[model samples]
Target: MVMVKFLGSLISVDEAVNKATRAFKDLVELRIIEKTVWDALYYVSAEDILALIDQPRYDRSAVDGYAVISSDTTGASPTNPAILRVKGYMSPSSTPEEYVVRNGEAVELATGAPLPLGADAVVMYEDTNRVGDEVEIYKPVPSGANVSRKGEDYRKGEVLVKKNTLLKPWHLSIIASTGINSVKVYEKLRIGVIGTGSELVEPGYKLSSGQIYNSTSVLVKNYVETLGLAKGKYYGVFPDEKEVLREALFKALRENHLVITTGGTGVSDEDVIRDIVDEYGEWVFRGVAMRPGRPTSAAIINDKPVFLLSGYPVAAWTGLEAIVSPTIYSILGLEKPVKPVVQGILARRVPNTVGYRSYIRVTTRIGPGNKVIVEPYMLKGSGILSSLVKTNGYIILYENIEGYEKGSIVDVILY
Candidate 1:
């Protein structure tokens, strides 16, 4: 077997990702569309949302108590209580015109009730006693106490949500507080996943001795869906032949907003996907300086992105996450999906090449004395899919780091 040389110098993972994803930044601005706040979850906001009005809308009671002229309750105590006439009651739906408080008067107000026009503070019910037609405040209450002032939460012109925000349930609530039922968001981009190995077969089908079931498509598709920025469409596997792969690539690109092809990215003679991409588009990067995904490549044809990923499941996943995912976040102005991380002591030493970034799968356990211990599954297995399944999280050894020593504290990113 003849060994193959890299097409050019390897680029840092960061630079490779920038080139692969940011090339199509122009397309994101065009995808702005209106969606109901309920349907906008996970979609990137297209514009800054300014509050239409003050958040409280009006001064509101923060407790179930008596809305009163705060000065009337001044100097009141258990032995010498201030007495005030009970003007009326106010519920959350009560109109201010009906329950206005006057001098030495109070209105019984429930929590969230709009403060009566003349009331300056609320004396909680527990601190007052109700008499025939008057209430006695046992404690002095200051002005603005227990009152949610108008515009306190958000000013009328303040930004409720910034442009390119990933809308969450709380974001929807804030938008709703502004009386906005719909929001402008970038529509979910369409991504096509195509496989290019002749030896690949569909799952559940009888495979020949040399053939393996295609798993990269499943990996890429679900990953895109979970990432929430794009909708993945799989265009069935194709042969490595140039004509077949070319047709497949064109069809997938035309049908989807972007395309990522698995397999046919190696340096071998049969790796003709690179040739097809070079013939039609400009190469963004031929390879990334990372282990398990050194063959990762990307190109842009007519402003559309096409990522070439390895057929190996782990490598394909790494390429999608390390490159494709970050690019989507950076170019579209969406926050990247943050993985939960834990701090733990390394169970064993893990080595890495100085120039390559490595993602080491690991499982953690609570060892003696409640110490969190991280166990790396394997240090070198690009094609071993089971390693990912057995591991619950991963620790990233950056390009400059050689390795981690056992018993050293490290951060683990839990999937």
Candidate 2:
């Protein structure tokens, strides 16, 4: 029921988050258990993995190619090739018998064969012509040519990635090369999502004249799932009646670590979540100084954080970012999630509100001279979902800033 302000009582986003974080002060003992490598794809962590290992490891080659010394082929060219007599071939899986590459001799090497004594390079068969016992090298192979040195891709004791990193395929490859069988990652938090509105109905169900499709429930669920941070449990659609919404919120708060409710945080009479939460729980903070998401609400109910987010898709997303995400991060003991930010020139003028920070969707790419050029997406209303789909990300307008002029450098957080 409280509308947060900035002047005497209003706090900036940074200050607000800081205060909220300090208020908690490690109140929750939730330890997001570390998952194995196989589970890393589904869950991200708040800790870096590189800080765990202490060893030098290398991935052996998986190919078959000659490993030879390089200095012997310097003057060898395609026109006047250098010829070296075939000494012998070494196969992998068996210890290689040491054979010195005398100036005019080429020792055959299987893929992954360690460089023989006195050999520094390997020339592929395609680049050489063989006549009887002698091979003609057409290209000048440089020293260390075609060689994957010890720990070229990874080194001993090198922290591949820090804790709290989302494991990608490339990250898996790096650790796999280091002979790491499993990894530690934070466990995914469970989220309970409740949607409340008498005018709302589930998409597949038959709807009456006054009922609209339930968009908030589905959108909130999808957003939570997409981040790999939490699994959402929908409590179905409830009516705007205080008793109905209150019961749903109560159940959600009890069952999950985080409860996110969409569509009932606005100022309209239909909005009942704020009043209900205020009656049942202590309000951490309410309202924010951001456009399209001003009606955001936060509270701690029965020891669990409850977020009553705005019904507008963008507003809901912002509310989640401003309130819910920080709680999730703290619960999992993970670093703050950062949106991809880049600097670009504004393609046109963008007016701003004086007291509120505005986030505008934008399309950006590297234009002439490799400079980033960002054009603001034309859609401005909180109701337009297509605008977000069309844009790559958002550009921020500070609370005190009036507007942005064309050609001005702006920072954009890419989608």
Worst 10 residues of 1 by lDDT: 21-30
Q: By TM-score, how accurate is candidate 1? A: 0.91
| Residue-by-residue lDDT tens digits, candidate 2, 1-415 | 6553322244456655665565454544445565555566756655555523322222222335455556667788989888888777766543434677768788776777655666777888778887887788888887777655666655556678877666677777676656667766655667899888888888989989987788877888888887676788999888889987777778887777777888877556677776786687877777777877776766777777677777777788766666566756665556766888899999999999888778888999889999999999887887677777888888888889999999999998877
- lDDT by residue (tens digit), candidate 1, 1-415: 9596788899999989777666767754446899998899978788999999997878999999999999998899999999999988889888667776889899999998999998999999999999999999999989999999988999999999999788888998999989999999988888999998889999999999999999988898888888776889998899879998888788888878888889988778888887887788888898898877888988887567888898999998889878888887777766676889999999999998998998888999999999999999964567898878888998999989899999989999998
How many pairs of residues in model 1 come into backbone collision? Answer: 0
In model 1, the Cα lDDT at residue 236 comes to: 89
List residue ranges in candidate 2 displaced over 4 A. 1-10, 23-36, 45-65, 78-80, 88-103, 109-113, 124-127, 138-143, 267-270, 330-333, 336-348, 364-375
Give the Cα error of residue 184 in candidate 2, in Å.
3.3
Per-prediction TM-score to the true structure, in the order listed: 0.91, 0.82
Q: What lDDT score belongs to each candidate, Candidate 1 first?
A: 0.87, 0.72
Scored by Cα lDDT, where does model 1 land? 0.87
